[model samples]
Target: MSGHLLMGALLTGILAGYGIAIPVGAVGAYLVGLAARERFAVAASAAFGVAVVDGAYALLAVLGGAGLAEPLRPIAVPLGYLSAGALVLLAGLTLLRAVRRYRGPLTVSASSPVRAFLGLLALTAINPATLVYFLALILGRGAEGGGALFVLGALLASASWQLLLVCGGGLLGRALTGARGRLVIAIVSAVLMLVLAVAALTGGSPVG
Candidate 1:
């Protein structure tokens, strides 16, 4: 029975992680595009930023369950709006910077990888979707009774998927080295971010 329970928790955690990470939303797009510009080291940091938050949320869900969700419910709408606005602003800034870089003698400065990680971390943290998803999983997936092993399983799965995304983004960067390719990707990602922002505000399902 103990072994069976462990296997059940493991499978549940894997499902929960994939459920949250599989969606390619504005955040995902920005991650890939940013990596396409900044390369693997920075992108890996950013990916960890996202993964950490997801793990934290999973842990919270397991510990607090619906009790946690209830308190956050009241603020969900306002937080959603705030997150949406932030995403829109980020999109605009990315587009503006891309255009400026393209128009002039552009020098790409090496950004601090720590900053990239923290920036993505904050961005992902603000998205209420993470909490919501974890809450649903905990409530519906029999996670409330599971122990630390369950949370560990969820964290490992989420981190693995996020790292895979980083790898894909790195490959994309290697393949698209030209300025034109970068600019095009930047613009496209910006547009996607805008759409995601609008969706976030309107109570649509989360992509990141």
Candidate 2:
């Protein structure tokens, strides 16, 4: 790849990392909760898990396996709907839990680091938009060569950004360790998730 192309790839990777990571979806919420209950080690592992899945999808896209996009295209609408519904359901459950005055540290019983990793990995992998993003990148460039470098850049960017998020959450968790503070954060997060989920379902976008 030319220097310009490499730079472009790097820049694109950064943007993609920020774009995907900024959304406070289920995974993000879970990360925050995990960090609040556990330590940075768990959160970092989960974040890395997410990055690995995202990187895999990016690679698939760059390799012109955009054909994978085809199978998903048929179910895109349904999956979007389902994802939105699931988000809503999760939000409702969260809201209910909040209202129930459940005051206890968040805990995942008998859950290992590997389970957390796999959970996030599977969650991110199911997101078809990741592939769509890669396909868009490949089509825009009109060439698949040098995609390995591009994928590497994107993966690095994504991993860095995700790790930062986990660290930030961990810090926040440390700062907000009181019971009242945790409750407030949990309530706010649940409310926001509900709103986002509603918007996502009604917006008619394939993946919002």
lDDT of each: 0.80, 0.67
Over 4 Å off in model 2, which ranges? 1-11, 23-26, 88-111, 204-208
Tens-place lDDT per residue, model 1, 1-208, is: 4788878887787788778887888778988888777757888888888888888888888888888877887888887887888888888988887787778764854556898899888888987778888888888866435656667777788778877877887788678777777788889989998898888877874348
RMSD of 2: 3.4
Give me the displacement of residue 27 in model 2, in angstroms: 3.4
Mark the regions of model 1 whose C-alpha exceeds 4 Å error after superposition. Answer: 104-108, 143-145
| Global Cα RMSD, each model | 1.9, 3.4
Q: Which ten residues in a row have the lowest lDDT in candidate 2?
A: 199-208
- Please, what are the lDDT tens digits per residue for candidate 2 over residues 1-208? 5787777776776666566666656667766665654567677787888888777877888765656767877877666676666656656755565444445445553346787688667656666777787777777766635677667767787787777767777788789877666667667766666665666567533221
Which predicted model would earn the best TM-score?
A: 1
